[model samples]
Target: MSGSRKYVRHLSTLVTFSVATLVVAACAPTSAPSGAVAQNNHTDSVLTVGLPGSLSTLDVAHEAGILNYYVAQVSSEGLLGVDTEGKIVPALAEKWKTTDGRTWVFTLREGAKFQDGTQVTTDDVLFSLDIARDPERSPSTAVYWAEGTQVEKTGEREITITLPEPSVNFDWTVTASGGLWITSRAFYEAAQSYGSSSDLIMGTGPYRAVEFQADSHATFERVDTWWGKTNEKAPKKIEFDFFSDESTRLLAQQSGKLDISLQIPASQQPQYEALSNTQVTTVTDRSYVGLTFDTAVAPFDDIHVRRAIAYAVDRNSIVSSVLNGKGEVATSIESPEQLGSHIGVESARSLIAQNLADIQTASFDMEAARAELAQSVVPQGFSAELLYPTSIPELGTAALAIAENLKSLGIELTVTGKPVEQWITTLGTGEYGLSYMSYTPTTGDPAEITGWLLGESNPARYSQSDVRQLITEQAGEVDDAARATKILEATKIALNDVIYSPIWWGKNTTAFASRVLHPEINSYFFMSGWASQIGLTDSQN
Candidate 1:
């Protein structure tokens, strides 16, 4: 490891679904208002974003908090883009390359200035990586970056990172941000006693914090000196109104008090679409509900037991009811949405047509499932425990259906539910037998899944060496088409091993008023947060 990076203690590993939405929104700007509306103390220009959760902090080094996702626009800058269409475009660094198989170099653009008017340099990049790689740092994405990866300030205009391996999908890890984007060293040093309650944030993006009320709400003003310039009608200001209830957010929207609402309750999505002033655009990044078993434990230790559980779940019903038939029932982690370069269908043979053939009409095949369960190593009868996060509605509904379906298979089930935080904590700390989890695609990168699935340090703890090797091979293959093929094959191997029973992915939908334009939407984050290039049109959801 070099100065740019460090080996932190084992990361409580793995990035989850919300981290995806939080990242890009962080890169955009939170501002006061710009243009025509600025003439008024309150302009039509204020883009008031409402989120269901609370913002914990504006600092990226800390929690990749959902609320911070709203204010990230005012906090950070220069990200490697994973655009809305699943394309990896440039956001901060103009161009970058790799060397020595393990070392990667990024060339910073010359004129790019921080929000403070100081030009960006290798030091800023090194410090940012240091934040991510620090054990004391509160990075939500510590797991992926908490390895033998190192970063160095090679030159004024460039930085380099040397990983332990060739890491073919290394760029994808950059996309799997745990909120370690660049921050000013001066501001960071000033905010001492770095605790959960600390009031400290310094980002190099388009906006600066004029007021941070914490939890309840906060406000930001545009930096007139931001380096990147967008043609969009950038807002002069941005405000986030935090509410625990979606009704409060909806009320804000109805009263013409809000310009953008990142989320509209599922039931309200249809109504939002009907409103002439709002527009709804659907974006899908893989968000599948899965049943993961602790293979290190009994029965589930048996492949037969895992397969039986897979057969017991009625995924088709989940697709129709929960997902509104918008997403297909997925059997494998390798989604078709991943760019072919990262996930090739050819290598995923066993996981595809053949493995999925029986699942196309997946149902509660109680009799067959029972027979399979009966063959497990359990002596008399086997009882299965199902754990799920209460915050995720789909998990509860899916768990109930599964409990009922699994009962038909003669396997008694104990469904345990906990709030998202407790449930995730329990997962990493070991408090459940089987759990419901979701994954946010780091990009369209299929190879990205390899790390989560097979990495030795995976919180999921899927310790299959063959699966690990296959994924490792896929990532290191330099040839584009060949890499895709290896990725597909690796996916097939993992699925054949039944790491988890996949359900349905959520269709990402961003609802905004007609006046809110150029959201900078992508699989990762909303680009609208960056005040520089964003333009607001009289647009709707």
Candidate 2:
């Protein structure tokens, strides 16, 4: 993945909050009773969903936002797919294996056909991979395919891929999360604009796009000829209505106008939970929200200054007061869910805890912060500005809290909110001293974010030879435990440097009507044809 833009596009709208008072009023709800279901006694064959943001395009290649992936996955699929548990599973490819980490062999699923009734040829897979790896066509995903990598068809139903170097987690590159969506060569070549409303793309998934109006709505229908087994009781039609405003989505859901609402803000969780016909599900998604410093710049360039800011911010209070206790205070750059991809969740947590036990983290100590600042190049505190995305108001709230804390150390921290697009550009161009950083992993590999944060091309412009060396060693380390240890080692160094101050790992909220029954819901649920996995509840049926 491109260190600058790949993961940035997946920044979710799940944590929007305007004020701390609102969060306090919307206290966390008690656990729901077992077997609880929505009580809206309505039967409908269409599943209408409201998305918090508008889709600019259905083109996964050109615009691969999280929402775009959710819609595109309905009809398009990659060689691999991520299950609800965040494990890689077979999609276009029925099975795959590799004798050496560099070379992989895959067997295509037999008799799989696209929605157009044409067989999913090996040529289609090869073409899709080519597009995915082409820098011009897919700049965000091209990094997954190293230079000099090769792909060829070995048989009618088999293909082989050879990477320039060994990669233990290369399989993640072929999954939807990695941005490789397969489409027939003929269809792509014939279309004037692939994935456009007039020429929407096609794939072998359970549903086919029937209509799409940019920034308005997109409609899809179930494909009876789908090769994979689908829920017989699943809705016949899925309609996605875009609502850029969060309140509109809540209103739509409350008015019985929507069956599902994606990206429900954490502040509104209590309101959604109060709905008798709705169920609100929140999961700790694979996302990291933090404070990032341009280490190459002055003041922040001083490790003592960086460490002081880290110690000043109260992460626990931010998560509870500003985030409504929906998220957990982050301990490292990578989320526990991302690290747990190799080891179990508990094991990942234990590994992080064990490694960070001796290391000093920014634990909200004003006295420690002042002492560190006193030892910096500027013994007296300095002024700096922190940029946050205006769309996510909670980030602004967190920034204000941090700024207030910094005041105790004689630091004047200015908090400013910018449009998300401009904020991203400012961060990328190194135009700001301090900024709020958010990232959602594009791949399940634990090394994904770590490599970006510590590697040579890290956005922070901070580099350490030891950390870079460990990152390189872990990329090709086939042993899961060993690779994890290497990553943890790198994480320890980064934390010690305080280039990035960990804030909170985010939680994603989704509201489902009582009539809908989903098999599973998690960070990875939208990576595949999730709509096909949902059906009407037994009571509604």
Candidate 3:
């Protein structure tokens, strides 16, 4: 949510809060065909997962929504994968080793074949990686982390990757991004359309695409011969039914139609928890929502003006009131779970602590905000527009709070709401005065956030030569301690510049009927490895 991927909003029909109480009739789960037998010794033949956002594309190359990544992970696979514990595990590649910082060797698992029955080859790996790195075809979000990486097939089962320069956590970069999903070149070349639910995407994952209806639902049948199979119960078929309306999704959950539901509303969490046959799982994530300042704009150009807004907004209050205490105060873009964010050596810890201290010590003082505003060029204070997506209720609440806070400092703030697409377009233009945005650290590495701030289209048009140099140096450095020091140093500079007004770190809440079991959900954006482990209890009611 924090890096380049933040701009990729879930495209859906905007549902207003006024209509949230009107629940659409819940749809019952469709029955599996008679031939669809339970796979991997599971009792249930189908797993019904309800999604609040619609899947934009099945093509991994052009996937934008975060849920689409989960669909890709279950239907396709990468050379590597992140497990629920946040460790890098084998997917397509059974094991890998690196002799030097620049070169890495990977060995594919034997007998592993795509859903289409074609044996996965070294050529497929190279083809997928090459396409991912091609900037013209894919967004920079997918390939920027692997900019100068080159791949060569050494043998039938082995491939070697050579980096232009050493990258500290290169494996993580590939596992976290979407475009790295290994696809069957033969099938893709012959197919009329890529990423369509209708198109058969041949992947080496646990599930195979059986049926796809655009913006409606997608059904996937389990592969009995999948290499990653475990003794745990595996759903024979997984169906992702898209219900953009939150009320409809909640109704589906309450009516026993949905096996799993994600992003449960804070207000409705208690209602679900009180139910006898339901369980809620929540995990604190690296994603943070913040107000970004566009420095190209007049008032935002002044450091004092930026710092004043940072001090004026109470992050803790937002977390408690707007988020219903479902989040934590975010001190910086890089969360504590990410590497180089107080997770390493003493020096790195000290640097991260300093940034947290800066955030903590700042208070919401009206007098202080007025003092800072007086020092700015526009002492009389000017009218400003605050933009945010109308779809997210918390964002609107935060914006209204910020507007009130700015008013106390003699700044007239005008809050405006736009659809996700329109809001993202305005953010990219760098023409906005003030706006709220978010970043979820997809890569467990901190460099993703630092490197993204330096991107041309970043909402915060902050350009400091020292910070940029440090980011570049840390990006290719293989030594963890060295990279941590550089990354933390850059973080301090960015915090001092007040590029982003830190808000709150959110927790991903997933709800499941009491019957749903064994699904391995992780902290990453995409809930990888979910399909193979989920199962239904004998008592479906």
Candidate 4:
């Protein structure tokens, strides 16, 4: 989430949400399928994943961002990968040795071959890194390398990266989903094109870019001569069908056309499940959905006001209707699944136990919310336009619900929905007072959500300096135990600050035809993370 500094700590947090377990029991384990016809033969088969947003471009290097993550993976390899359990795994690099907190030596796997048949060399690693660490070439979120960076090939299989200051998350940072990627030093420098067209995108991964159609679609094909066989679940081919509307996407899934789609109409889960040849894969994720108040402004600067709006707002109905009871409504950014081991399944159990009575859950109490609203300077009938991004239907409902809730609290709120691009531009410029959005921590590490989302200088203009300092100290700590303690401590401190009314933690939802694979069931929909680990049954068609 930090704009600067790449890489994330290989984190391992326990999750106890029963959503995955329940979905599997309801859908799979049936005696079904016959041969490759009944069972899915992912081997050499083409699999396509759907994207809700439009793809801006295929220029992986210059247009690197989350919306472009799936595209980047087709052409590059990260030094490391964050596994399903949040543990860091070796990818392009075999392993790394940390001399101090500032320097790292990575040992590459010998004979690692690129798509072009060139053996991966230390120079290639260095060359690719030099680009990522360079502002002129890399699209890395952080520009920290401008401070002081020493990158060199120390040996045939060894590379060293030295930083000026301690970047506790540096080792993991370089491998942030879009940060670490391998490019041939020779081809990288000589190549005039980036990922603009399929011809320009190349990588050592099992699949390589073959077709790119801008916003319409993109296709990938298996590298028959790929070097790694360990990735058994890797698809032989992948095609992404882009659709801005949720209805068309869901229709594609029902028609047995799309192999998988992330946007399953929450209300249509049952209809899809009833299909004899359909399997819906749902997972638990470290995603959050909450109301962000402009803490930097007055009226909302008071924690009581934030709490009043939260208490008045009924999140349960929204969860049941909008999320189809598939999500865990968040009482805070940190959900029970993320902290379930430490306590129970309540959203704010670890953060605000003593203040539980004051903070409302998904359920709303109009009376209590109104009393707090009276304390505010809101004129007898103060009303403001609540901005909602029309790109996401959930935000629209959220805006509507929020507006209705505030009215009960004596603060009339008008809901106005707009496209994401317009909403972002207006929100950033402070034209919109309040809006709805989701938070997905780049790193599943607890500090990620708490540190960035609640910190001051947040694009939302919510600044709490005291909370921000705690986040910094915790992030800077190198020790494992100390970092954990600091993270939890910070969580408690920030949530109790009541800067914003935490609503619900977002859920990772996806619909797969019953005949497809149920790979790794988890809350990370975007990653569908364990797709490679999944063994699919044959498609009924």
Worst 10 residues of 4 by lDDT: 10-19
Alpha-carbon RMSD, each predicted model: 6.6, 7.2, 8.4, 6.8
Ranking by lDDT: 2, 3, 1, 4
| Model 1 CA lDDT for position 518 | 59
Worst 10 residues of 3 by lDDT: 12-21
lDDT of 2 by residue, 42-110 (tens): 347778888755655566566544566667667788887766666677788878888777888888888
> Hey, what RMSD does candidate 3 come out at?
8.4
- Candidate with top TM-score is 2
Whole-model lDDT values for every prediction = 0.55, 0.73, 0.63, 0.54
lDDT of 2: 0.73
TM-score of each: 0.80, 0.85, 0.83, 0.77
Q: In terms of lDDT, which candidate is strongest?
A: 2
Model 4 over residues 393-416: C-alpha lDDT tens digits? 676676677777677656777787
Q: Write the per-residue lDDT of candidate 1 for residues 248-338, one digit (tens) a residue.
A: 6666665567666664445567765665566566775444446666677676778777777877888788778765665667656545554
Q: Report the Cα lDDT for candidate 1.
A: 0.55
